[model samples]
Target chain A: MSLIVFAGAAQFVGAGMFGMGVGGWEIVLTTFVLNFRHFLMTSSLSRRLPDNTTKSQSALAAFGVTDETFAVASMSRDEKLAPSYLYGLNFTAYTAWAAGTVAGVMAGSILGDTLKQSLTFGLYALFIGLLVPEMKRAKPAVTAALCSMAVSGALYFQPFFKMGSGWMIVSATVVGSFIAAVLHGDENE
Target chain B: MSKLNIIILMALVTYIPRMLPMVFLKNMRLAPWLNRFLRFIPYASLGALIFPGALFSVNPPAAAAGGIIVSAVMGLMGRSLIAVFASGVAAVYILLLII
Candidate 1:
């Protein structure tokens, strides 16, 4: 999953660089845009974990707190968010992500550059296929999505902000999510 | 600009935001209002990624028109997500192939 994120970043950066070359601003923007979700994930998970959990455990477990890991942890019915279990979930996910990335990068090293380029779209399609189901049944989820799109679109054209697209994306997501959560936090309760 | 430098810069910048909340948020509880905001993150993020690329495809207006139509019909008719997305994907590719 991280690798997919990386590939997406690579494409955006590579394409941007290809067209405009590297600007410090573009790099700054793309990085921010692509990474905002992790912060959201962390914020949510930190709230979900048991209050008694140790700081070290919380921090370590956070290493694994991703969308996939969050889904797993949140789904577990246990009321107390055990640091051990959270860390365990993080362990497995990080391991899986790292191992998969290594295997892919190593294997990709053997593939032609064009083939690798083509694989980029497959990642987006895979992401879409995976993400679409999550949005379909949940109205709040759909609302949240629309909010993000609106924010991103608005940001794209705004001249005053002068921020890179990446950071802009993050800002849009964070703010969009905040709006979604405010209106829809009721369902969880 | 070297690819390595650009990638490393992205790595550091991206890493800070992604990892910061976990390290710092351990002490911070979700405020009543903020909880509502978090629920929408995944949905919105996915929307942010998908809508642009799909709508801005080779034949933006046409493919988007088709995707929008198919998505609406499938969604309204209570078809499965797979069915809904399949219709949209088919619409996109078919439109692309034609144009």
Candidate 2:
């Protein structure tokens, strides 16, 4: 059980580490990029927080501003966001995530190694599931995703450029994003 | 580094971006281009994540192909994340069992 917890924590500690070899700096940078969306969430939610909210309180609240928690906090009916409410929201979401991870780890241990190996594909499938919704919504998403796929695939297989998975992923992300931003305009496609 | 160390590092990396804008950049306005670039980051990153790795992650080629196809179809159909992912994994697992 302790081993499972350690293994689970090692792998699922953050979305960025899922299904990848663990290199310290690579993990850190990949996580930073994965959670970069939080910048927008925090920016939006921070404004809703009470103007006089202390820096310490704001920082504390910011720590918990994940996608789910941010959505809940941002959707509150009250015009003014209370620090207490933000804290409660964050606490609930964090507890749920932690508990869920523990539950999964426990269940996984019971299932043993063969099934666990098969389940590794689940993470990749989940990534695909996440991307498809956005791709459906935006033309640029489709373009960028295809571009990323092509770039990453080429980097992985082509003998001339032997890029590591982490670096390849990051480079493809940058290129895809740059191309998407250039091609996508406010005007309807 | 140890698992605990990696987790802590993940926490720190995750925290910095979430903290910075709320702390110091609350009043600052980002350039329009930069905002648009950020807008597209998630999709692009997720894209970079899925390819080559996802397809090649599983064995036999058939299993990975089956899983990806099922997941892609479910996702395109607007299914929930869980449903889409489960279907994919299930497809792969079932395929493995048969072969």
Candidate 3:
């Protein structure tokens, strides 16, 4: 899954849904929605790549455009992004991700049930860890997050509106971000 | 769908967003409204992923809440991802042990 999906959040969400026995389409749809941010990152990074970069090279590098890699690439002081640099960066990050998954699996096998159950919260911790920084950085981020929490909470808990987790996430994200975009108007960053 | 089939489809969907913009939309600029919408997706999606579900993730909901609070506090303090994540797991473990 790590080698194929190559996305942390999507993999985590997919694993959780799979554990709960959700349908395959739900997993696929949720993965797509969760990973849609890659479009923005790759679109922004494309401008920095040297004009002479080949299509194959760009395609290969695109597979590695995780948030961490994008941040490192975007922070480079060089005017033109070098293909070699990108390849190296992507290679390293990809290797680490795959290797980390292997390590996690090995550790999981060794861990007891109680320890494993406790570790379930690690996934939520990851989301909160990633979101809280953004919430603190901008008021609009807070608005978007709060709105999403409200929508998803309702969708999950309300009998009338009860839906699959996949749909719940998709709807909440769309409505929350759309409201934030309309209300904040992109000025606050 | 079979697991292999699901994995293949996931690969395709994941690749689309990463590949299309860099390969085909290289020179194009998104409209301002669309860009703003995309910009907010991460926060919104992360939020949706965290709440309500997180509460039920573990046996005792309070253990999960403890993990969340530790994570959020460390995150707000701008701690490293590993620190926040490990501390959160630790908090849950401790809470579970107590309860």
User: RMSD of each candidate?
Assistant: 5.9, 6.3, 4.8
The candidate scoring highest on lDDT is: 3
Ranking by TM-score: 3, 2, 1
DockQ of each: 0.34, 0.49, 0.57
| DockQ, candidate 1, vs. native dimer | 0.34
Model 1, CA-based lDDT: 0.60
Candidate 1 chain B, poorest ten consecutive residues by summed lDDT: B51-60
In model 3, which residue pairs have backbone atoms overlapping below 3 Å? none
| Each model's lDDT | 0.60, 0.70, 0.80
Q: What's the TM-score of every candidate structure?
A: 0.62, 0.66, 0.72
**Chain B TM-scores across candidates:** 0.66, 0.72, 0.73
Query: Between 1 and 2, whose lDDT is larger?
Result: 2
Put down candidate 2 lDDT per residue, A1-189, tens digits, no spaces: 222121232234444454456576777665665566566557656666677788788888888776456544543557678889988887776777678778886897698554665687887787777778778877877877888788888888899855555567667777777787788756343
Candidate 1 residue lDDT tens string, B1-99: 565666666666555665566566666656767656654565666556555544554344565656656665665666655666666666656665566
* Candidate 2: segments with Cα more than 4 A from true spot: A1-97, A112-114, A186-189, B1-14, B21-27
Estimate, for each residue in B1-99, the C-alpha lDDT of model 3 and write its tens digit: 998898899999999889987777554577877667766766776777788888999988988888888899999999977899899999989999898
Which residue pairs show collisions in model 2?
none
Ranking by DockQ: 3, 2, 1
Worst 10 residues of 1 chain A by lDDT: A117-126
A-chain TM-score, model 3? 0.60
The CA lDDT at A43 in model 3 is 70
